[model samples]
Target: MKQTIIITDCPEQQGWQKNRELCMDVTTYLRSDSRMKAGKSYQGVLRRDVTCDEMHYNEQMVFIETSNQKRMKRNPRIFEGEHITITRRDDGSYHPNFRPIHLGPDFNVDHYATEVANELLWGLEGLVDNA
Candidate 1:
């Protein structure tokens, strides 16, 4: 299945000190047949207006695949009009073309998606029926 997700903001690019992972403000529903409501915890390829040459190196500045305490260096730039086209697999895993950034351990997709949905659905308690 193919789904388009709208990205509004990235806290890490906005100078969020405690934030490390690259989380986006999604404004699309994942499972519902609704547009511009709230996105689900789905991961996919995000196409941005900017490009990043991110690389991970070790203490000796040598490129390594996996490292316990890896050091990463990259030219991080954020631009407007960033969105993603997520591709779903048979195993129900969303794989994006871009690599996942892990600077810290504070970014959670489910938590962020829930927060966005709650914010957008706020003040509409009467409009939506729980039952």
Candidate 2:
């Protein structure tokens, strides 16, 4: 069984380091669920690049790179091995204008996304309290 998970309609890609913070936050849960000491699979969703007709991932895809592919113009961090990758694929399961991608099986994308959203959103309750 392939371990994969996806969360559509994720939080906005804004704010100072918000995306990175959130990813790091989610990475915690992943560290606990994976059967492997470390994950070996990469996952993410595919969406059209707003700047062009080309396709790109909505989020950074996780990957474990061991060799330096300098010719490919990959990020320097990924060459460190076991790190999130900034990669986009040309093929995937297409539906309408988006493609669903999973970040391996270490974490449940659907469940964790909901859990994280709820956890974060709960703080907003005070702002809505009788406002």
Candidate 3:
């Protein structure tokens, strides 16, 4: 299995560069768990123009292993592209779609990112336990 942390903004490089710290943390978090067979290394892809404009839209998606003949219904839905994006903003800072920064819409970039990571890891945990 492969895991990635992609961060994007207007300029692909800027977005990818900015969130490396968070990515490192997430990488460490994932590797520390027993289920991470790949160890601490990760491959990432960042982009400018992306498929989803809103980053917070997909909290987390988990998918079953393709090799499995029968897929079991799991808690976390897995898929691909564990990405984070800054879609809406003002004063040049990323803002959560649910959170407007001032009014506190709902989830900010950091919070939203954390939420996504948690969901993904939680799903992986389910896989490990079931296995």
Candidate 4:
């Protein structure tokens, strides 16, 4: 099933870095009319773009680069006008394997993807958080 969501606010970067790569945890401070609960908003990590030379400096960097490469190989980044469509699991269940959405430029395909992913995360049965 495809759900449509309109993002009211752009993602705001949190003060802390999530890893050595300095990727920040961002929060989308907006409520939607979709599956998102009344008080809840979406949260995600901001990706860091590293140069090729930086990857050779440390094992962690190399590993991060390798992992990123592998993930991109499996599911490449969505472009400006393209949205990632995740197929529902068999038996008509929602699986929460969400992907990262590009947040640059106008919030069209990327923003919608992020909002739908948040909806899937917070709305799906047995996955909703009570806290």
Best by TM-score: 3
Specify the highest-lDDT model's number. Answer: 4
- TM-score attained by model 1: 0.17
lDDT score for candidate 3 against the true structure: 0.39
Candidate 4 at 5: error in angstroms? 34
lDDT of 2 by residue, 1-47 (tens): 34544444543433223233254212212322343345554333323
Evaluate residue 119 in candidate 3 and report its C-alpha lDDT on the 0 to 100 scale.
51
Off by more than 4 A, model 2: 1-105
lDDT of 4: 0.40
lDDT of 3 by residue, 1-131 (tens): 33455555555666443332221212122323445455544223322321345554322222222232355333222323234222323343322222233426674878766866765565456545856
Candidate 4 Cα misplacement greater than 4 A, ranges: 1-107, 125-131
lDDT of each: 0.37, 0.35, 0.39, 0.40
User: lDDT ranking from best to worst?
Assistant: 4, 3, 1, 2
Give the clashing residue pairs of candidate 3, or none.
Answer: 61-77, 61-78, 62-77, 62-78, 63-78, 98-105, 98-106, 99-105, 99-106
**Pairs of residues clashing in candidate 4:** none
lDDT of 3 at 60: 27
- Candidate scoring better on TM-score of 1 and 4: 4
> Which residue pairs show collisions in model 1?
28-38, 28-39, 45-96
* Model 4 residue-pair collision total: 0
